[model samples]
Target: MASRLKKKCCTLYEAALEVVTSRYSFYKHDLEMLPDSVLFDVIYEVYEKGGIQPLREAFSRVDIVARLLKITDKRFCLIRSFQGALTSMFWEEVPRGTEEAVLQSQFLVEFGGGVPNSLAKGYENLCADLEDTQVQVDRLVETGLRLGGFLSDAGWFAESERILLACQEIFKWARKEGRIWLQILECCQKLLHVQSSYCHFEEADVTYNASVTTVVGLQGDFVTANLAVLYKEFSALHFNRSEYSLAHYWAVESLRAITTELPPCVIIEVFRQASKACVVKREFKRAALLAREVLCLANEVFDVNDPRYADALMDYGFFLINHDRVRQSVSIYELALDIRLAMFGPMNLHVAIAHEDLAYALYVYEYSSGRFIRAREHADKALFIMEKLLPRNHLLLASVRRVKALILEEIALDNMVHDAGTHILLQNAEELHKSALDLALRTFGERNVQTAKHFGNLGRLYQSMSRFQEAEAMHLKAIAIKENLLGSTDYEVGLSIGHLASLYNYHMKKYRKAEELYHRSLDISLKLFGESYSGLEYDYRGLIHVYHKLGDIEKVAQYTYVLNNWKIQRQLSLIQEDDPLDSVGSPLPIADVAALFFEDDLD
Candidate 1:
């Protein structure tokens, strides 16, 4: 009736409302005091006058009548009750005062049915001449679903849930009458999406169970495809709960049932979730392989220049870098940068991110072969973009500045001499490192991972300046923070430990301390990436030097044999690189090579 009143003219209802509000409060008891006959007379007069005005002075102050009617929601459902009043006043003279009772009856009928579907019940009663209720039912379901979606998007979850439940009830009614199977499934999907989004996990679990049951009961071609979609939602449900193993299991199950029926986006999401799960489980090789498949699927499904394809490429590139394929990642990062540049121009945050990633790749590549110029160029570009786009102390700005500083440090070390120009280069590098560290400290405080990273970068810079005591302090801080936050066995903690080891072995001549640190760092690295890690070479050399200084000839010879055997194994692994997606070979210099390359004897 509210919907109908919106479509039709409600001038008389407006006049009555004006008259009632001016005389009495909007309370139900106050509105009930006005006589039915007198109110009807006033409405009729207003209708006759073309909805001009309603004056309470036209009636006597003491006019009262039967109190059979009740008010709800602090106002009259004016048009609905007024319609009955008009019918009795005009045409039903014998039943002159019967309209008020009819109004009350209609209200009771609607109140019994429920809120969203109450009007639909009224429609059924009014359209009793139409025998088919199916058309009305279909319209109700369609309108309710659309409204539910709109309300959900607007963050009105309660209203959306009510409307969807009404739609579900309609479907249930239809099912009892032996109709509608797929429609029920579709409604369940929509309802469960909303339930999951709002973290109504218990309700979503029930909906999920009902959807699975519906799927089992369904008789269709490729029912398993629908089952796969359900499985995908289940995976997401568990993923949100931080149950990675269950999420991965369901994701794999969904992948197995993949067909042309499933959307391309769903397929990509399944692979992405599986890959993320593998990463959380520390199955890096498997994660990289799955990430490669996501890139392949995205390349085939999306346009080459699409942002989604670029995003997939970026993910694949990051995984490749993590799994020790930095050279390939450089090209991947280049492609992502090109796409973002074309899509959003050069000044976008995405473009800056791509530059930052490419810069990191080139920086890591320096230890393998050396690309200092290209790496510095990308790092500077990233810094320039970030400085323009971000606030002065933004975390991203701090990160790009750190990368540029590291690049400068590398270049300065490469041009080592007792010359004025080299001193200026070192000075610039130190300033950038200090600025990055200050920004990190201000933005994330002292205990954050980013702050720890900045601390480690300063340690490397100070060590280059031959400030061994300062470098030791900085490395110790980084190690303490990383060990507290990321655990002692984290890859980052190992890097910090190794940096301190390098500082002791190469600069301070603290052979015993250097030996202990190198061994501890090696133990951490072996636990993280195992025996074939290429970065272990740096630790081996440090141990060899330490043992030589300590006059332990047996220990020195043992490390030499180990280092030589490691080099031969690395050579054989490079020869065995058969697949582009294979990330399980001898580990290359994993990220942050500066931590491992303090000495020129690394090669």
Candidate 2:
């Protein structure tokens, strides 16, 4: 009955709503003074909420009384109104009054069946639909490009594509709407997913495959933006794939083509996405440079005081620390931290993150530069900020504790350098290593990659103090974990192997093992970067050193000869090399000829 396209019941319901609205409140229970329309409207509101039985019975009785007396057409639903209301509730899954509810109803429909079909084949149809939609939308874009611009006023209104997407989404929502759904969904889906779907008059007849009538009514600023969005999604997902460089290039083009003026924050969002893609590839230098450029653009286009600019500055600081440029990164981070403090006060999560990050940076630089006292100060600040923001056993606070212990050990190593010949430093290093091991094991779990990092750092520290046996154990555990988590061919795994090989070559006098590890590390490093040439430089030097330790004069000479050839080849490569900082636009220097020491000395 609800699905029946009858106009009288809907009209009568609206009339009833009018009579009772001013005088009747749904919550009221004053039955004796209630108006006649109150009964009809009460049933109507109940029907809207899907409250079955009570409203249905009341309306059915009213219908019978009116029918027996032949009360007439205008108020006929007065008796069967409740039944009609119930029927209208979910008929054909037509959209509710708003978009959100429509999406919710889709979920409700899906929940009608329990369990997934439990096989890949069950999902094939769903995937195909999405792909089919993608194809049609692609065609829509080419048509729009050919036509040149939008066609009408409804098309011009803000978010016209949303209206179009709504048509498809609403239709796709049903198991029964089929053809009507396809036509409507395709119409909107084309505007967003395909550009060439918009018909062009000039291309009409034998001149074109489609006519101007194809556009329907696509015009105005909003329509232009809708079309531009299709182009943006296509470039982001297809042409660029993973390269941040290509993605940023297209984002700029598509953003400019849109007729509407996007907010500065939205523009900064594009920069954020591109920078993240760079970071995902571990291209820290490029990411930091892009983020810095974005920072300048954000502040210039928006406000110097914009929180987003400060946030961009903070992101650059993170990439710097990851790339080992902590010394130069400190000032930018401090600036961001100060800005967040001013904007959100001391306890904000943003301020806390900045404090923690700056502390981590200061810790790395302090120990490297022999300033443990200043490093400890920053560590304390980090601890305070983290305590306010996280639980007691949070991994970050525990990590900071390990950093403090490392700082103390570094101070011990400095004092022992003049007096005890590294014996005291070695002892302090053991205790600090234990602290790192304990904290990392408890905070990140024993098998975590981060736990392995702490082990490796401790191993290197011990190797520095000439504690060969202990360093060997730590490095072995680190290698095993790293090899399992990151493939053996990864640069980090190679670097760890090289560190172990160096200890055996220089301090332990284990020449055979040193030669074996060096070969292993070299093979992996060469696999990853041999073609790039720069990567091969470090690994080749390691191999040369290994050959020297084994007293293989012929092998050493052979490796050395290859290294020289590589240097010459590097000079000739057509890569857009960031000319060395020392070069400063001058002709490249010849290292072999200009060297102060003889090549034989290196041998």
Candidate 3:
């Protein structure tokens, strides 16, 4: 009986293969006509013994098998057919464009509901009788990771976390098997990456530390590269937490752990993180050097069109912006934007970030009609992308909205200069500022620094519109918030004071009140940055104007002398000709304000 059954199975398999190869057109319906037992045997044998071509041919007709599984109520057949499909697909190289479809199919088979009870039982039995547990574990890990990645990309943080945690467990089991430890470590790193991406920093830190400990415990010299990767992730975690010092330290450690055997991409990433940390710390020269190295290495090691090269360009642009090279920075940002647009198209988040950065730099470079239009265009693109990709109340979306509001305000101010339809621009600016303020209030609350900054911006906008009462109310609200959060002597408080002083000096013509506010602002500026700081020049000039207006000769002389001497000192210090920070008696402006939101150093 056994010999006869074997002969029958062989004959059925040969017939099925022949039909799959020769009658490809009707193979689907033909395969569906076969008995379930014979069909299952054929699929299993083809997946296991047949080479890549036959497996490909078999899977070409897998849809029919899938339909048969749905049509037939045979539980064993359903489970066996699914198992065979999974094996074939797992081993085959998924065609490039069909990744999403393949992943969807795998997800359905693994977790989609409506599996027959007997099929589930048969699957469990198959798992129990399988000799190679490692293969099963690997399949589970692969499926879970792919599903988790899909969820992560779709912004389903909670679902992705659940899948990633499952993958982590399977990886833990694989670790104990004494083989594939490096692959297991790689899996753990991927979990850490997903955790970090979703802002689950605490859990990410735990996973990172655990993975580091595991890699160290393995005591294999071959795993040093993995150790470097863990350190790089640790550095990124610290960077996200705003611990630039620790971030730089770990980044250096990662570079140190890497040898010639490791890929240069890892080294480039370390340098990128290290450069970002240096930028955050205001180590401009070192940051510039490291950024240049990153760009050079990326150009040498990666394709010129690769996103890594664009990332290096973006970082260099940011560094240039920090050093007050706005035009140079804008050009670099344009290059980065072009590369990203070419690589990922216009709607990508990276493209959005490049647009935001370039808009800010253009706005700061000059507030002409041309630059204002360009700035508004870029700001709108950034806002559009953020609206599509992020939740309504996300802090990142709020930040983009704030930048857009600033660009609109700049356009309104530019129109006010020429007296060319200022009302419409001002109204649009006002609306955007209010929307941004609302978002900031919702995301960061009223007492937050971001909320206070929005209030200050709106107050400035109102002052420009000659809405003095509303402007006073907004400015005072901003000052109250800043003082409450950062105390009276903070530089931010000084900014609010100077803005109010400007309102009184230029618009209200209240010289006495303006003089008082200017004095207060001068004191704060003096304390925060000594007399030599450029910000003090604004306070000094404001006080000079206020004292002159008030007909106070002695105070006027004192402030005039101070202003002149500060200018001479600035000359001696060799400050640039067109320093934006040297703007007289105004808030730091949107460019500096935007800097406050970029605390992460990287987009």
**27: Cα error in model 2, Å:** 39
> Tens digit of lDDT per residue, candidate 2, span 122-225?
22223244443544444332222211111111011112232333333433433433233234323542443222111111211211121122223343442443
Question: Candidate 1, TM-score vs. the true structure?
Answer: 0.54
Better of 1 and 2 by TM-score: 1
TM-score of 2: 0.43
By lDDT, is 2 or 3 better?
A: 3
Candidate 1 residue spans exceeding 4 A from truth: 1-262, 266-281, 368-370, 578-603
Who is ahead in TM-score, 1 or 3?
Answer: 3
Candidates arranged by TM-score, highest first: 3, 1, 2
Stretches off by above 4 angstroms in model 3 are: 1-132, 139-166, 172-185, 191-224, 227-262, 368-370, 417-459, 462-543, 550-603
TM-score of each: 0.54, 0.43, 0.59
Q: What stretches of model 2 exceed 4 Å from their correct place?
A: 1-277, 283-293, 301-307, 324-327, 341-356, 359-373, 387-389, 417-447, 462-467, 516-548, 552-603
Query: 1-603 in candidate 3: lDDT tens per residue?
Result: 888877655566578575564544455346667776666555545444433344334433323333334333343333333333332344354556675534434433443212222222333343344344767776555545544443343333445566567566655435475556765677676667667655566688788877877777787585777777777777777766445568778766765666656667766766677677667555565576567666666766666666667787887778777654666688888988997766544444667788999988888776434458788889888887666555566556656677777777776675566655777777877887888788677645787667888899899999988999889889999999988866787667888989999998988898888888888988875654456555666678778788788888999898888888987876655455443212213222223322432345533
Estimate the overall C-alpha local distance difference test score of candidate 1: 0.64
lDDT at 43 for candidate 1? 43
The whole-model lDDT of each prediction reads 0.64, 0.50, 0.64
